[model samples]
Target: MSPNPAPRPSASDTPPRRRSVQCAGPHGLHRMSYLEWGDADNPDVLVCVHGLTRNGRDFDELARAMAPHYRVVCPDVVGRGLSSWLPVKTDYQLPTYVADMITLIARLDVDSVHWVGTSMGGLIGMLIASIPDNPIRRLVLNDVGPVVTAASLARIGQYVGMAPVFPHFEAAEAYIRAVSAPFGHLSDAQWRQLTESSVKAVDGGWAMRYDPGIGEPFRQTPLLEDVSLWPIYDAIGCPTLLVRGAESDLLTRETADEMGRRGPRARLVEVPGVGHAPTLMDAGQIAPVRDFLLAAGAAGGGR
Candidate 1:
């Protein structure tokens, strides 16, 4: 008898569609790349955005798990991933990011979407969700909040635009492992996935896939104290869920507590032993998010 043929991958296991849409910025129009998974006609949409210096691929596992229930769309957010770089570096701020998302949503032809944003991505979600009649119906602020500590800002500033070129792929992986230690104990395969998607082959060596100029606007501003956006947080009316690394320095326990008490009054979940942020790769980390987003009547009130 002939050997059994290789099994075909399941729908959720299949790769997502690589798509792009043009977005207007301060200088001109720029291309934003995104990954789409699940039923193209499914109107139940989930928009997952990555943190600063990261890309849409960060949500690969989460998207796969969620694709069965919702149409998952993860964007590279302007300067990162396969997206175009802005000619004006200062345009890398939240306003430009929010506008780009709006354009992406229009292209998707969706009336509303559920948002899962990590760090900088979370801030963008907060801004978009705060708008009157905005498209975001449910929000997941992963390991971030309206209040960000100055120390964490300093830590992130140290390397946002370093633009280092590695001699080999291993070197690039090592660098990612070092900086992303707070991602909390990922396996070798997981680490490889993160590194491969984060770097690109250049003339001399491998380099990060983002524009170095993306850091210009951030470095120009001095962070003297904790960055607080209570007004923005207060403006949001949709259901919000807040996930924090238990030992995170960026989003303190105190701030997360207050976040539960006010506007949108997000329900909080903490991943033990992690710091800075949770990668949401493993089953444990993905459960709360999946549950919250898939739960019935999540729009009425947070769980």
Candidate 2:
């Protein structure tokens, strides 16, 4: 018999390349950069977005694990990472983000996509997936929901947008760790990666990778409990997974449970010994997300 054909290589082994695409904004047009992994021609796509201040590299572990199955795209969410900063700083808002994502999906030229969003990223996914003609098939909302606690908002506002200059990488890393302790149970390497992706060397020394001006719009708006996104959340019909950290201050257990009872009737998974969100940097966290997205695809509109 002929020797067994060589096994197909895993896409995880392929390093991602920085790709730029133009996006429209109220002021005009801006460029959004992303890390592309897996086969460029692959139709199955997965888009992972990071938290408020994080960059595309946050999904490095998850992308590597799922690259074998999907063309994983992780975006820097303009104003952060390698993407272009908006000329009008105050234009940063959910609506702007959703529009940029639309531009991104158009560039991908895919039939449908699976989405994973953490915190602010999750809010963007909710808005996009809610649109009647949108292409999001499966969505993973990581540690966020319609309701945001005032305490959480207060805590987040205390530091967001403040780009305190750091004398060295170690000092910046330490700051990240202090502010991000709510992330819970991250390895030293993971923390380092988070720090590296979050900062860059400025003329004087070092500062955050994201534009501090993004906070302009945030400061103007209040994240009150009364600011209900239930209407938007109810509009999304895609199969959804609500992943909450057990000790989360942002997404409470009540809200996570209510999400299961309405709208998409999302399946819920609460990660123990964590708060705010799970980093998904390890096997245990990655497994649930992988299973939910892939199995949902296999179901063929089973939801």
Candidate 3:
């Protein structure tokens, strides 16, 4: 079946609001920044989380398309984007990330939420949704699953925190394009947008916005084999949808099939030509997420 057409945000709708909340961590607290779009009063909320190294701004196109129907929230997971870095680099683990999200949700003052998580974000969502009586009414895992291959992990480790400073903006854009080639074909404007949000001006030139130390944990723990979370995947009971990149090296077709047969029995969709993850910046990618979150019987539907 074809994807449902996404509605464009109306002219009168206001732009997203930049906000932050102090979240408790292993050491004291740190601020987690997020962008809020659509009606502040709207109870129906959709939280879109980005991949491992990317920030919330990656969802700008998707957020704008869904803002017309739901209050869209995009968060810069701690240690990425505008969010503050951890006092201890190793604190970048999922436990810290999950705790921070709990604080963010409490601040939202909502009983339930719909989630769209990409790659690392999907893993976070899986753990949360697996909990008994999780607030996530529906979940969308974009190009990631319970089993993460060691080969893919090794590939990402090669550059997760090794970006170099560029003397000019063009250089930065080129670097982003080369490293993110797996995101598939994106428009020139889209590439520029990614570059703009990813870097900040430094004394010598432009540098990555995230803390380089965030890669410490990955370097410390070398994966000998695939990491599996089948127990967590089977614990989730909410409605779910899984989007996979046809050529993805991370979430294999075999694992995705198992996901569909167990737990919430997620409906699966694969985007051809993409790998690792699919940046939900276009209509084709955004429609499946929108339809799954807005479908009848979905939590916070028709609000």
Q: Best lDDT goes to which candidate?
A: 1
Clashes of each: 0, 0, 0
Q: Which ten contiguous residues of candidate 2 have the minimum total lDDT? A: 1-10
C-alpha local distance difference test of each model? 0.89, 0.86, 0.87
Candidate order by lDDT, decreasing, is 1, 3, 2
lDDT of 1 at 59: 97
The parts of candidate 3 lying over 4 Å away from their true place are 1-12, 300-303
Q: What is the C-alpha local distance difference test score of candidate 3? A: 0.87
List model 1 lDDT by residue over 1-303, tens digit each: 001112223657667999999999989999999999887777778899999999999999999998877778999999999999998899899999999999999999978888999999999999999888888888999989989999999988988989589999999999999999988888999999999999999988899999998888769997989999999999998889999999998999999999999989999999999997899999999999988887766544222
lDDT of 3 at 199: 96
**Candidate closer to the true structure by lDDT (higher is better), 1 or 3:** 1
TM-score of each: 0.95, 0.94, 0.95
Superposed by TM-score, candidate 1 places the C-alpha of residue 179 at a distance from the truth, in angstroms, of 0.8
